[model samples]
Target: MPAPPSAAASTTNSTATLDDDEDELNDLRVAIAQLISLPQAGSEVKEKGRAALHGTVEDMRAFLDTGYRLAQAQDDRVALAQLHSKPDTSPELKTAVRAILRTSDPEEMRWFLEVGQYEVDQ
Candidate 1:
């Protein structure tokens, strides 16, 4: 059989793993900060990002992987609802918001919130 790894080799591997984990954690922190700073982030995204900032590494990773998108989608839905409910909102904008709400694609909804709405308004 092949020889087992030496203690030095084991320590080096462990140190590398720690370094990787630390790097990932730092990246997550930066992502959360950026998300929180966005004007369109809505309440759910901001709340989730704030929670992730204080949570464990796994929590941070989860936030970046799936939580952020899900939270943003929820916030986007709320925004659409608010737009639809507004008294002075143009028919074109309301129809566009309704169309976005019918679709299941989060990116499409996000796009509508970011760029498509302005196009509709203009």
Candidate 2:
């Protein structure tokens, strides 16, 4: 192989690219944080996140039936799918669902990119 390239010639541009990527990532994080801070973002997110879950509403009722709750972001997404398909669920159940929304809540619009729990809408 040729002699090792000089640091200035080969590596000077690498840092600039890395910095661009870092800046983008940081901006995304800030936007996500803002959405999480909003009270309604959680419920709004639950809808799409529920779609990501890909389950019927009955499946949701069954999941929650045991009274045991899912603590992980993926589990909560699955739970939302099940709830979304439920037929004619009462308002009380809605209230209860909202209550449980805490921790399961994902930042809205970003499609829960963080993959963890968030604040619930009361």
Candidate 3:
């Protein structure tokens, strides 16, 4: 029987996969942006560009959804660890765990990556 993956191996794989996803997402965004920057073109070309943009947007949504799931899992793991370490999981403890989970904003991540930015409440 095959052995389960080691923690180090799992982390490495996750990071590599996330990195590849980021690269693909960035490439798609760049392609769509380039299409937008071009001078006015024929209806056929414009239509194709719009289609490509829509598809890229869908791809991005997929990537973000996957990342969000992973983030939730990570949060759950941390919360579990906290529970294991302590006898009481109080309301304050639950609130702290929730705060940790909620601290990672997808919009903030995009802004940090310089993908795009809009005004965000501080």
Give all candidates' CA lDDT scores. 0.91, 0.45, 0.50
Best by TM-score: 1
Once fitted onto the true fold, the runs of candidate 3 whose alpha carbons sit more than 4 angstroms away are: 1-5, 56-122
Candidate 3 lDDT tens digits, 1-122: 99999999999999999999888777876655554355423233344445555675675454344533344344444434454356665655555445544656534332322322112111
Which pairs in model 3 have colliding backbones?
A: none
**Error of model 2, residue 72, in angstroms:** 21
For the record, the alpha-carbon RMSD of candidate 3 to the native fold, in angstroms, is 22.1
User: Please, what are the lDDT tens digits per residue for candidate 1 over residues 1-122?
Assistant: 99999999999999999999888778889988998888888899989999999999889889888999999999999988998999999999999899889995899998888889999977
TM-score of each: 0.80, 0.32, 0.36
Q: Residue pairs in steric clash, candidate 2?
A: 57-82, 57-85, 57-86, 60-82
Write down the TM-score for model 3: 0.36
Best by lDDT: 1
Worst 10 residues of 1 by lDDT: 22-31
- Evaluation by TM-score, superior candidate among 2 and 3: 3
- Judged by whole-model lDDT over C-alpha atoms, candidate 1 comes out at 0.91
